[model samples]
Structure formats: structure tokens, C-alpha cells
Target: MTETLPETAERLTVNTAPNWRYMLQEYDELYRYLPAGGSDKIAGHQRRVREAIARLLKRNADVRLQPRAVKPVTAHLRRALDEGRTASLAPAVRALDAVAEDLSWQYGYEKVPKGLSQNYAYAELAGTRGPVVAEDIILGVVLFAPGCTYPAHAHKGITESYVILSGAVSENHAGVYVPGSMIYNPPEHLHRITVGKSEPALLAYAWMGERENLHEQKMVFTRTRK
Candidate 1:
């Protein structure tokens, strides 16, 4: 039987770290976009998702790591384990779990010089449901440190979307997005994201195609030595 939304939310909450509440809420919202016939049945699902988020928020204060510097010229791609392989998404999930663990220990944010930043990704569908279409949506989290700028970039076949899980993010096309906000980048739309002060920012995103071809463009800017 198809699992009920509440049950699914509960399972997700129980399995993830405390910081994942905001991310869970994003998934809950995605559920809302499902067909309307099951709305009532899913009400409990929404509640479970909210409760999970609340639990996570309450535990946020317990996080103790500090943000690290991200250099402009360095590219921080935590290579995907499923790259060039037709394996199941399980490896991708493990990769994300590993990244999350590392991020938690090292703090959520990483500063990438003026022109670049760090990224940690996990592909959920690959492990659980196998590949679909030309690609499958990979779910992962990205942390950004203050003063870091992610140069403009675009994905050719893949459209991407992010849900702000913590802190704040300033996007060139979408403006500033605070926690709980969502942003969408249609296929091939050039854009950039810059982190702000106060704390490291975390966002949950989905890469919609072959991970390799996802990034089609990067921002252009003149550089000067400090």
C-alpha cells in the first residue's frame, strides 16, 4: 500500500538529523502539489511534517560547529558516487549521508573565495527508485558561508530549485531568501547565489538531470587583487 503522508513524514523525521526539519517542511510542501483528491488524508501528513520541523528547530541550538572559508578559485564538488554508473540511488543516499555527517562535524557553511563556493549533495531517488527520464531528481543540501559568492551558472537539461533550510541566501535573480523560502531556476537560466552575514546558510535543492550536464554556465566578472 502507498504510505500515508503522515507516516512518511514521521519516518523521515525519525531518520534524519535535527537540522533537517526545515528541509522536511519543503518536502511537505511538495506533497501539497499532489492531486487534491487525497487532501484530507494527507492533513495528518502535513501535521507530522510540521511537528518534525518543530522538533528539528528546537534542537538547532545544539549545533556547535563553526563556518569555514571557501576560496573563490576552488571548486568544491563532493563527487557523486553514481557518476557514469547505472547503479541504484542507494549509493547517492549514502553519499549525501556522508556529506551531511562531514558538514555537521565541520559546521554547515564553507566559504569559497569571491568566485566560488562549496557544495555537498545527496541523490535520494537514485537509491530508492532507480533512474527516471534522462535523469532522476537528486536531493541534497548546500551550505554557504558569509561573504561567499557562487558565480553565475546554468544547467542545460536540468532545472533546479532550492528551499532555504537555515540562515539567509541572496540570489542574483530572486533577491534575498530567508529560512523557509523557495527558489526555482528554470533550465538554462543563468544565476548566482551569495551568502550573507549572521550565520551559515543551508538550502535543500534538487538537480533534475544527469548531474554532469546540470551546470551549463558560470558567472563572469572582472577580478582584482586585494
Candidate 2:
């Protein structure tokens, strides 16, 4: 479960300048893959994220970035990055991985099934949390350990998008998604993710919509596959 971060428009601070810069650089690196055809919904969602980041960059850089204490989930990120050395991954994924250790990360779905908690985590670049530039929008990276299954969940008043950075994940038990694949879920879209058995998965995500929509962004957990 995401924490209830109090909203404050104060110029945010980071632990260091370079780490913040690298994270912002990922916005451009990721925008290059916005799909041109097929589903207009996805194409439009990608465009919105790109534009939002563009606006974020125009704001004054009030950041302080530092290496956060490594969490257990980070181990899987490290392992997946090591595996990606030989696998085909987007250059943006590689760049983000190089600085993965510097971002602060947290677990989602507090009531998740036993053991699943340690298998997944996310790092926020902007939100109610620090480095917050835009309101009602969230940009971050999420990771799951190999063989981990992020349980079924639904969001209230939120539109979320994810760009798969590395490894593979099965969404809704169907399509096998790989690097650069984009997934968009409208409010209340019920979905779960299962990582490939041998490699972990890393995904860059953006969420926007209602609730106070920041501190109150509600991501409700449902059942898990048994």
C-alpha cells in the first residue's frame, strides 16, 4: 500500500542533483517509444505522460537525491539488470537500472498475501512524495522478483500506464509483454501481473486522475492467484 503523503507544493528537495537529473532524463528516453497506431487509447496515454514530464522539467529544479538504504526488492532489480546485460533491453531501461539503487522505494498493497510483500516494490520520481512537481500525477519505476505474482487490484478514479522496461510479464494471464511494451488501465480496471519464471521484471509507471488524488490515491487490492 502507498503511504499517505501530505500534499505540499513547496519546492521539493532531493539528496543530490545528479540522481534527480538522471531520473528526469528517463522521461525523454521513454517517450521515444510512444506507439503510433493500433489502440488510440494507449497512444494518447503515452502522449499525456510525455507532455506531463515536459511540464515538470520546465519547473525549477528543487531536488536533493541520495542513495536510499537498499530494500530487499532491490536485490531482484540488481539480478534482473545483470541478466539484461545479455538480453535485449531498451537503452532507457539500462540507464535507469544503473541508478536504481539511488531512488527511495516502498511496497504497495499492505494487505498482500504472505511473502508477496518482499517480492515487489516501487520508487516514486514525483507525486505527493518528495520531488513532487505535478499534482494528480505519479511517475516511477516498479519491480517484481522472478516468479513473483503481483496480485489482482483495482484503482478508484485513476488512469494508470506502464512501460515495461525489462524482463517479461503476463497481464491478465494472456499476452506476454516484453521491453518497451506499454499497458494502460483506466479507472477500476482489474488486473494482475505474473513475472516470467526465470527473470525479474522492471516497469516504469505513470498514474493520473481523481481522489485528492494524491494522498488519497486509492489502489485497492483484490484476490490473488492461488
Candidate 3:
């Protein structure tokens, strides 16, 4: 039986440390799937991912974690998980369960290109959120509903990487990235993503660099969906 979304979020209290532990543990699990060739591309990302998590763990869980309204696109989360693209990601999938329902899933407004109907919900687990996990680096999950297209955008002084947990995504002019694909973008590199229409796409993205310069990133949408 499919587990329904829980309405009552388990009160995290000030004991969100365990939750953070699970989150980091999930990121660490990515190391288990490295290619035998030892691609330096992925290796570098793994290191940064760990470093970001480490920095986040040092902060205080001062703010209360609240459950936000679930957007209609979140309904596809289960479909993405059930697709079973990568079993090694089971733990990561399970981790989302603990917090997915509470996510403030919403459409990109100011950042989206003109007239594009893309909806995304991201939990900046570390830094950028209420509690502020880390300042220089960020850890978060991005959900793109099927048929949604994330317009081209770029960041300044921030290097970004996206680890596909399930479904598929195409970074404009870069080609399609499926399960287990590690797509990275440097600061000021303009890129866009389109999700498969039949199922939703979920990506665990990391941002490393100057946190103060993050605002320098903005959407630059030039295409319209036909």
C-alpha cells in the first residue's frame, strides 16, 4: 500500500540534530555509488558535499521547524520514488519521507522566465533557511514537477552541483541526466532544466562559495514552452 502524506509533522523540537544526522548520512551514501574509473568530477563534488554538511552541523537549531503547505506537484513525489531507478538510494528516498510532506513546495515566481509554469520546492537543509545551516555552502533538495521547466539561471561566486536521486532532468544544451547523474555548474554558468512529464524529478543540489554573493544569481529565461 502506498503511504499517504502525513498531515501532522513529528514535532522536531530542538532535537533537530538527529534529523541533520540523517540528512548528512544520506549524502554520504552517495560515495557508495562512485564509478570505478574514479571520475575526478564526482570525486570533487563528494568532498564539497561532505564539507558543507560538516560546517552545517556546527550551527545551533534555534528556529522551530514548521510544516509548510504541500503544493499539487508534490503528489508526484511518490511516483518518482516508486519508479525505482536506483535501489542504492533507498535510504535517501526514506529520508525524504521524514520531511517531504512539510516542504513549502511552490512555483518559481521571480526567478522563473516569463510565462513558464515550473513549480519547485526546496529545503535548504543547511544555510539559507530559518535556522541557517551554513553560510558559505548550502545543502538542499529540489523538486520539479513533471512537465515543468526550470528556466535558465546563474549564480555568482557559487559553484553548484545536482545529484539526481530519481526521475530525469536535462540541463539546457548539456543533455539528459538521469538517476545517479552528478551535474555541476560553476558560478555565472547559465543553465535550465526540464522534467519528464510522466513523473516528477528530484535533485539534491549543493552550493559552495561566497554566500554573500548568492544574490548575484538570477534567472535568464529566453525560451518559451510550446
| Ranking of candidates on TM-score, top first | 2, 3, 1
Please give, for residues 1-226, the per-residue lDDT of candidate 2 as tens digits: 9899889765443324555656666765675565745877777776777776666666644554434855577878776666655555456666676666567877655565787777888888777654544565788888888889887887787788887778899988979988767777888899999999888888888887753755686556786557
At residue 82, what lDDT does model 1 achieve? 26
Global CA lDDT computed for model 1:
0.43
Winner of 1 and 3 under lDDT: 3
Q: Write the per-residue lDDT of candidate 3 for residues 1-226, one digit (tens) a residue.
A: 9999869855542245465567666776664464424667657766766765655554433334545756555666777766633554667777766665555554434654443443665666555553333456666778777777777677767788888888888888468887777787877878888888777888887777766665344434455458
Q: Return the top candidate by lDDT.
A: 2
Q: Give the 10-residue window scoring lowest on summed lDDT in candidate 1.
A: 125-134
Per-candidate local distance difference test: 0.43, 0.72, 0.65
- Residue by residue across 22-65, what tens digits does model 1's lDDT show? 33444545434433234453344334333433453444422222
Model 3 earns a TM-score of: 0.76
What would the C-alpha RMSD of candidate 3 be, to one decimal place? 7.9
Error of 1 at 114 (Å): 6.9
**Residue 124 shift from truth in candidate 3, angstroms:** 2.1
Candidate 2 TM-score, C-alpha based: 0.82
The collision pairs in model 3 are 127-133, 127-134
